[model samples]
Target: MSQDHSQDHSQDAGAALAEGRGRSAGARSSDQAPSLRPSLLDPLFAPARGLPGIGPKMAPMIERLLGTPERPARIIDLLFHLPQGGVARRLMGSISEAPPGEPVTVGVTVTGYRAPQAGPGKRPYRVLVEDPTGDITLVFFGMPAPRVEKMLPLGSHRYVTGRIDLWDGHRQMVHPSRIVDEAGFAALPAVEPVYGATEGLTSRAISKLAHAALDRLPVLPEWQDPAWLRQNGLPAFAEALRAEHKPDGPPPPVATDGTVPATPARRRLAYDELLASQLALALTRARSRRGPGRQNAGDGGLLGRIEAALPFALTGAQTRALGEIRADLGSDRRMLRLLQGDVGSGKTAVALLAMASAVEAGRQAALMAPTEILARQHHDRLTAMAGPLRLRLLTGRDRAAERRATLSDLAEGQVDIVVGTHALFQESVAFRDLGLAVVDEQHRFGVHQRLALGAKGQAVDILVMTATPIPRTLALTFFGDMDVSVLDEKPAGRRPIATRLVSTDRLDEVVAGLGRALQAGEQVYWICPLVAESEYVDLAAAEDRFADLQAEFGAVVGLIHGKMPGPEKDAAMERFAAGDTRILVATTVVEVGVDVAQATIMVIEHAERFGLAQLHQLRGRVGRGAKASTCLLLYRGPLGQVARARLEMMRETEDGFRIAEEDLRLRGEGEVLGTRQSGLAAFRLARLESDGDLLEVARDDARLVVERDPALRSERGRALRVLLYLFERDAAIRLLGAG
Candidate 1:
């Protein structure tokens, strides 16, 4: 929205604007309400249904797009929903001067209306409108003639705004977006904001609601440092937000360079959101530090045994990571750290050593996985690696007798370490003295689950691990509350997989080549195209491919998919793990934490259908053992730009960190970490790709604010409290003791 457009809407909305927009003077007295939220934010936080022109029926539709189960859509949410772009309306005197496929606003008189034949399959209703220079047809499909006639009354001069296209060599417009009289046309801006539409809602309706929401903004005090705001040339909070909602002219949402215009308004608002997120994280970190940490780092007695038993030496990166994690464990402050390592970068060894450190201190440790298969895999790997400590496996699939015994052993301190799924956090399970908790694939379980596990013990140190290497920018946004440790080196004796791009046209040759791998007693993982959108389609694809491979390889081929029963899926995985089956045909269910040492060959069908990060993960499945590995990406011809780039990047480098950065550059933040899949709230205003620099500055600023005003008693500190609540970071506000 442009500034001119905002004024136009505000002019007519003055009559509807509330008399007391901000908080009353009486409400801000010394005896203010005990609520953490200030009274000034009431208007902005009001229910969207109360807005003008919004009916009860339309409220649910708005809520479906932006609401959560706990909270419905509010006026603030509508305000945050910014425009995608704008269409510039070029005022033309006549139709003859209108460019062929360009937006034009021309004054024309409605001459007549032409209705189509009454039938299911028929042409659109046409209206004849003309100027003195030339004439153009106005088309509306599936619209009643009466409505069309009423809208464009005959002999009425109106401004028609929309793109003019030469259809069948005749100048016509399928839909004239706006056909308003002179008075209505005068209110329309040259650049009209374009909004994304949802089911049962139109962009025009949303724009109206958003405009009404904007009128409720109150005068907010500046929360940012005065010197810093001047140094950055930033606008005030309300001014920046208003500028974003109302655009005036050049530099639309997307500029001609195919990049978002880093206008002053956008930069200011982006900084505001980044500041809120970073401040909340800083407060959370402060609270986490106030807890008494268990001094779990003991003399390297158990850790020495594991290191001595390993066949290969630890990488420099892994050694550095252990030093950092051990330092945190030794300090009195509670340890909340992230152990980030690329796929097969030896993170498990580091985790095992960290767990061993806790056990050496006579405290229990537990590793939680997201799935039962992963939990069991971790159990098997740890049992083989860990020779001395008593380790137990607990999962939802365990029999009642086995589960009861494991629980008894855990409570009695007989189990020194345990690996399981979310079952570890069940209320019935009690830990004698749990000193450390390591969560695998931290993106799958968010902060709530971490806190749930922490409740079982006293200040239990947490070290969440991710095989998907995250870029530094996203590291701040997702794991801002925790310290980070990255393992960048691959261990000794690990071989790089030779990646090859193959066309689907040579399917027969690829299958014949798999025969040699099978005959050599080498394990193979044959993956089908990613489940496009549904599981049923994914199941069929995997089964169909498994059938074809089974016919060729007799009984040695097995299939695994997410839809199969747990035991059945486990059986297929066990056969592949034990070398009973040489080839495993599967879907993306094997994407994460499924380790098979002998699986040397990975064949991904329709590789173009997968994202770069996913393709990298699948390739990591191989090259785990000392044997040389090969990854074949079978893609169809005429690949699109993004898909082609993904395959090329896969062939270019095996560095997961570099791949992660490229993934962020190619795609957005969502694909890099699977934000929606992980159930983590994404920043509604900040674009990580463009605003990463702001994140670093915001982080530093937040640290400074927390250090200076620990309780937020200062004037600027009080304003910052409103900033937190404005972004719905009220969870962090409650920690401030309701200033």
Candidate 2:
């Protein structure tokens, strides 16, 4: 976890895992333009060891705190280190007027000194100081006698600054933060900036390093729109960085409750960061569409065949989503689209139809799932409904002979559609005319992995699908490059899940009710909060619950969790699917894409511990069947406002989109569970809740600039390119060159 000293800079200062790890700079783009590095920023990108005081011993310490494991701390990283807050140390006229415990500077005469004895047991060297209002003791834990005598001769006047305390029946100053002569007093800041510190690195030391960084600030062309900056009354980027580091007066006022305020200077810096991110995404989107796209238009022959084979009709939302994807596939520009829906919202059907279109165009399509179970699930479902379209399943679990045959068939273009996990991206899994690349549960795969898969086929149309409905802010940050189509409606006959919150103290009553439901021949799902008993967590474990349920239900209850072997988990799921077991107790391993039509009960243990969106997903498991489904959210008592709000929202509505929006507002975007792995740009200064208004402005600005100047050759564009490098979006610039 990152420690914030003055304010939360987790988004800004946090070293994000590199955008697409394992991607070589040469491999990403075949651009003709010069390298993304413009000669002007070389000094900033230089190694931290090049800094005057940063020797070998100190460099590693700084890197550990500020740099990523992949890259050492650079001078540029130090340049972006904004102060956390300000510390005020205004000079007080006399010790009598100085407020106790508050920092104050005082002028005093060194009246006398008490040196430690020649041989002693932990004695401090004390110096006596006096002024017109009062006298005070200066305490130093350790000081060489000769040096101390030379510095503070008896009766010599000196300036001391530190927090004063009433000690041992007299006033005293412990280890003065600053002691200066008359000339040095004139240069001391009335208020100083406070920064986060690491071991062996003092706040004062960090402040000195930051000042050194500011001294090297280069004069550059303006990047922001002149009108926006003028209207906002914001300073230039360089001026803003300087002003934030050194306030002219007392520090900006924090809220009475101690929350950090978004001062104008801070907001300006925030805008710069947000603007950089928005611009990079806009550029990437533009680059993806720069070249002529492969128009894999089909005659709908294969789609018609698959549709005829389906057991049920398509939902209106799914049909509309399919239309959008079809249009993208037909267009001259490559299709980079995102398909979002709630759990069990039929995303796979749309994906299968899209793949059929690719096959009709004489091109093979591949669907990559994040897990083997989900991949196999896709293969099974599609195999039954795909009609005559040739389909194959590829996974690590495949036998060597089977795998070799599948690979040969895929390379020879005999397989029309292939479904698999990350193994699909293996070097050996070659495609003869790969057209569409569909990624299921895209949040689990990083951006680089997606790119690697896309690189497998030139101008391959990319379609990413996510079952978790993401909020608008997150969508913009993570999938800004893709056109989005949402499956907002469930198919007809899918009943609204009846959700209820119950206290865990009433577990016995709930169990008795489950017994009755079992007697009525209705299937039940008992979801626990954890897989095993953890010393740190308080929630009930699935294994313990499965044992208890097995004891009571006599072999009718089934169990599965993430920790179990694949075959064992498959067996348990098969038992539940086949109705051999009526009650299945499990952990969240069944959170996504697990389908059991006969199951009608969802008992989520400690639901208050889950996010509102997660609770909604778990609840979605049961409503797939025709029978009425009840989602019993069993939670412990003494809930906080946020957790209570989450549970209340789940009880009130089944709309995943609405739940997602509420989740964003209730917990902010950081704790949404998937953003970290989604490779979304995490905002350092911009709060999505409060700074949402700026997103549109920044996005619009970025679009206009990229549309007018793709290569960043214009005066303003050059400066914007610098902004890109500063925020580590140089990858986007490389995309422009490749285009």
Candidate 3:
């Protein structure tokens, strides 16, 4: 989420712009009538033009860089856009003791100038200057000789700050970044904050905008619990913002770099943000609960039919999880729940049973998968388990007749269960009565997508399932609004996967072993990281390996990658499933939701390049069968510390939850599930790794605040509403509607 925060801020600006455009001034004022401080924060939320130093030309550029592509930039965007780092600008009188490669400010006299010769090649324009200690050259490229001479006339004094360089046994400064006279030097600070700026938007310009934003900050009330604040010694909201924007000196030596540190001031600001986020999720949950939902209870007839048909008995964890889902379905409130289970933990079985319950209630149920292949896989398995119940698969690949038939069945209440990809949410795929909507790979979809699915049927119960085991802290961060059910136990007779580490240097020996394994009538999965040859990345490709193995093993090898056509990929998988292809070479497309029961051996090439969670998932592929399975982690030599630790942990244990916690610690939250790709919330101020402790307190405080004043008309609630808007979570306020 840290990476998405910038994009989110931009979108927020765009939404604010659209909102401003649609409403008249009178309407805007009228909208603020619910609050006692009517439009008090409007000054802060106003457009960039409200800032003193920002002109019209710079406003669009600032908004382009600062705001999201959809909206205009505002004063609040500038406020949250904190500094990246600072440039220490200590004044120095001499340069003799100034070290090379370090920035130094020195005053010098303009002794002489050497202009580039007007010839075929463009040379540098050099200015010779001398200070009290020594003489140095200031080299400038692409500058006119007249301009150089005018700025540095003989005997004139100027101050400059730049990296001192020694080139060809001569002290030279290549294009000083900053140059000023005595009066300009006097105005410069000893340490200047550096900001993320575009070509037209400079750091100085952002700094000015930030200063203007700070000037307009309204004195905010303390929204935090007083005891918690006293215990933490946190500063007031306005005081924290001021201290962060205007540090007394250079920032302390902390990993915060140029961004706000976890100082009392910065932590206070972070708590405010966390509180706002939690409050928004809570409000959304509350608003959804306000809608009346139909109670679709089951008599256990359909569930018994499916479970009795199963060969193996249900695990205790599965029973508990099913009980939770059944309770949610029986209740009048809509079920917005998360079904979290690791790979091969029987999550699909539980989902099938839940859908069976929906069928027993005489309502249609739909299971949405992230991919076409996964949707088909779910359809195939559930169809087999469902016996007499009608199960249909819908995907984009369905031909006209097939698609028309499925749509007619769905809309006519003829289909009891339908499983498909995102096509389920399309406008044409109307259901007679969609009681339960089960979403697989929950993180892959966004919040609005869930809402859209819910809108298809009146108060549709949503049960999102995720194979990737998220840490407890991260689960709350991503799915705080929903009740969570964990399938901790694997099914009976499930064998523990024997994980082993091997180097790629022993390719011949490994091939010989694979030959033996194939001769023994066992299936093997050779996982590659890439599809085709990429010059930029030195990773093994599945196509090349498939070709290599085809020559050696002859038609026993099959390749499946993301670049392959949908039918080809499905064909390759089908051949592998039918034992026509004993060796399957694939990419990470096989990392999630792919279940191969006959597969007994797993080979992950360049395992060092994969994260801990992915390595765990890939390993889970082999242990599904009844036979004893082995996972060989093949890596090149010279593994990094993190990679070595990751592989070692995989070998040590197969606990998905533990691996997830370690993955969060090793890669941070951004790279684990991918902040942008998975739609994970990217926090701007608070870090999940270090700021996890604060999250619980923030959640509790937000709940208490909402509990006391659900309408948020109280004075403190008004201040908290401003906090929400500042964090781009004003949607929570709008959910309350005029109160």
For model 3, the run of ten residues with the poorest summed lDDT: 9-18
What's the TM-score of every candidate structure?
0.86, 0.78, 0.79
Model 1, 434-505: lDDT tens digits are 999999987776456777787788889989999988889888877887789999998878898999999988
Stretches > 4 Å off in candidate 2:
1-39, 42-65, 72-209, 249-259, 677-681, 737-739
Candidate 3: tens digits of C-alpha lDDT, residues 1-739 = 0111244421121011113222211113334433322366767666766677777688777766766654456676677777655656676658898778766788889999887877887699999999878999999888888988887788899988787899999999987767788888888876767677775676777787888899988776666767888899998888877766776676554352222357888788778877877887777777777788887667888789789998778889899999999999999999988999888889988998898888888888899998887888899988878877899999989999999999999999999989998888889899999899998987676556666677788788989999999887777777777889999888878899889999999978888999999999999999998888799999888888889888889989989988989999899888989999999999988888888899999999999988898998889888887899999999998997789999999999888999999998877766666554543436776666777788788778777877888887798887787777666575666777734
Per-residue lDDT of model 2, residues 492-574, tens digit only:
78888888999999999999998999999899888888898899997799999999988988899999998998778878888
Top-scoring candidate (lDDT): 1
Q: Which whole-number lDDT from 0 to 100 does residue 455 have in model 3?
A: 77
* CA lDDT, every model vs. true structure: 0.81, 0.79, 0.79
RMSD of each: 7.0, 7.1, 5.9
Q: In model 1, where is the ten-residue run with the lowest total lDDT?
A: 5-14
On lDDT, the stronger of 1 and 3 is 1
Off by over 4 Å in 3: 1-5, 9-68, 72-74, 84-209, 218-228, 255-261, 500-513, 634-644, 678-681
Per candidate, the number of residue pairs that clash is 6, 2, 8
Clashing pairs in 1: 1-246, 1-247, 2-246, 2-247, 2-248, 3-247
The TM-score of predicted model 3 comes to 0.79
Q: How good is model 2 by TM-score?
A: 0.78
